[model samples]
Target: MGIVKAAMAEEESKRQTAVEILMKVGFLDHCEHHEEIIFTVGGDEEVTGAYKYGNANWTAYQGSFKDRKDMTDHIKQESENSDYANDGCEICRSMFEKD
Candidate 1:
């Protein structure tokens, strides 16, 4: 029964992993899963966040989130404080926290 139990455990782990990957990539709809998770956001690269889909590390989709709150919050938290700011429009600037 040990082998059977181990196999079941491994299958359960993989199933959970797949769900996490799908959710991380924006297929799942809500922050409840990560509501309490610590976030470490960084600078505004060509894209803001990375998600894994299938077997790949994927950047956030353009116009994915309903609003910028999730993205902006992540960016503000991740990005180091910078004196050099990009000249951005209202829409673009909304994605970054104002000083």
Candidate 2:
């Protein structure tokens, strides 16, 4: 991979590692938003991904986010920035248009 791709991958790895850290700290088990988190890496729209899982589905959570809100909002912001209007998600361009 090129330097940029390598860097991106490394960043993604770091992001995931932060999440693992959260796992070790019991954030996923104790945080108020533990059950619902937006999982993403790289902050790249093309290859970036977002997924949500409930607290019951996970055992641990850890990270370096500003706070629980930041942790929960990252994926929502990413999905919104990507302009994805899926009903399964929280927001969409269509919703904005409808308002």
Candidate 1 accuracy as TM-score:
0.33
Give all candidates' CA lDDT scores.
0.36, 0.39
lDDT accuracy of residue 60 in candidate 1: 37
Please report the TM-score between candidate 2 and the true structure.
0.31
Please give each candidate's TM-score. 0.33, 0.31
Q: How many residue pairs collide in each prediction?
A: 2, 7
lDDT of 2 at 99: 92
Residue range 1-99, candidate 2, lDDT tens digits: 999998787656545544543333323222233334333223333222223331222233323344444444543443343333222224333465789
Q: Best candidate per TM-score, number?
A: 1
With a 3 Å backbone cut-off (N, CA, C), the pairs that clash in candidate 1 are 41-78, 42-78
Q: Give the winner by lDDT.
A: 2
Model 1: per-residue Cα lDDT over 29-75, one tens digit each: 22234342322222333123322133233233323333344434333
lDDT of 2: 0.39
